[model samples]
Target: MAGYGDDAGFQQWASENGYDVPSGTVAAARQRGSSYIDAVYGERFPGEPAGGIEQDRSWPRVNATDKWGNAIAVDAVPARVIHASYHAALQELQSLGSLEPVVVAAERVKREKVGPLETEYMDGVEGQDALAASTPLLAAVEGLLEPLLTPVGGFPAMMVV
Candidate 1:
């Protein structure tokens, strides 16, 4: 005669009677139950975007390619890494008080995206996670430039951006 009340009391009694619970099983069960309820009741998870918009269009479009002219996916990490790395390097250079050279270098690099040298670099680093690799590259650039940007001429104290 286990009604909901009896079921609840029985569960509590079993728990108090030294029933072993597996690690994380309660949390996992709760999550699965919650997701099932949401699915059935048509509730959205917090901050989940509504459907029908292209989510991957955040980055600027680029025609990635190999030296042999083979097309690469725009979502490919090596290409994205090179693109983000160049931009980050230019930002570092600008923070070091030379915006003009960085601009020129950026323009040059942009034009050289299809050149042999960039192709070689990309090929060597191909199949690696570009975003992960770019993190250390950015950190190293910041480390080298931070000391040179210390306050001067009544400027505010240097802060790592």
Candidate 2:
């Protein structure tokens, strides 16, 4: 699938941030970055993909609004999303496969006891998949996208009727 940001945008971002990537690999890195963005934040976005279920990438949403309640145009992908994609692409380029989700083994011991010691393990904090638990998105990207994201565990612009 095509990435949200183009090679030019990626190049500009790279140059401004002091990162140098091989010219030939920029496209693939951007694609990987877009994949990472979808995998990490797809469910938390404010609205359905503007292109519908078959949409390749997650931005350009329909029925979505900004943090200030301004409508996001159906044909426009937010600049923050594009910028965040650049951040993700740069990271992926620096370390191939760095954005790939990793499924970490969950804690298995709920409780344990030794001859003279007693210990209790709390339940694994509810919700969140092990994959997301292991792979964290870049903090800089997160900051850019936060205003466009729905609050976790809360409905975004839910309808009452």
Give per-model TM-scores.
0.19, 0.80
The residue pairs that clash in candidate 1, if any, are none
In candidate 2, what are the lDDT values of residues 1-161, reduced to their tens digit? 89987999889888988888789999988888888888778888888899899999998889989889999999898889888888888888777877774544564566788998989864433464445444655878877988988876633221111
Per-residue lDDT of 156 in model 1: 20
Candidate 1 structure quality by residue, lDDT tens digits, 70-134:
55455432322222223332333334322112223233222244545553233213443333222
Query: Which parts of model 1 are misplaced by more than 4 Å?
Result: 1-63, 77-95, 101-161
Best by lDDT: 2
**lDDT scores in order:** 0.30, 0.78
Clashing pairs in 2: none
Per the 3 Å backbone cut-off, how many clashing residue pairs does candidate 2 have?
Answer: 0
> What are the RMSDs of all candidates, in order?
24.1, 6.5
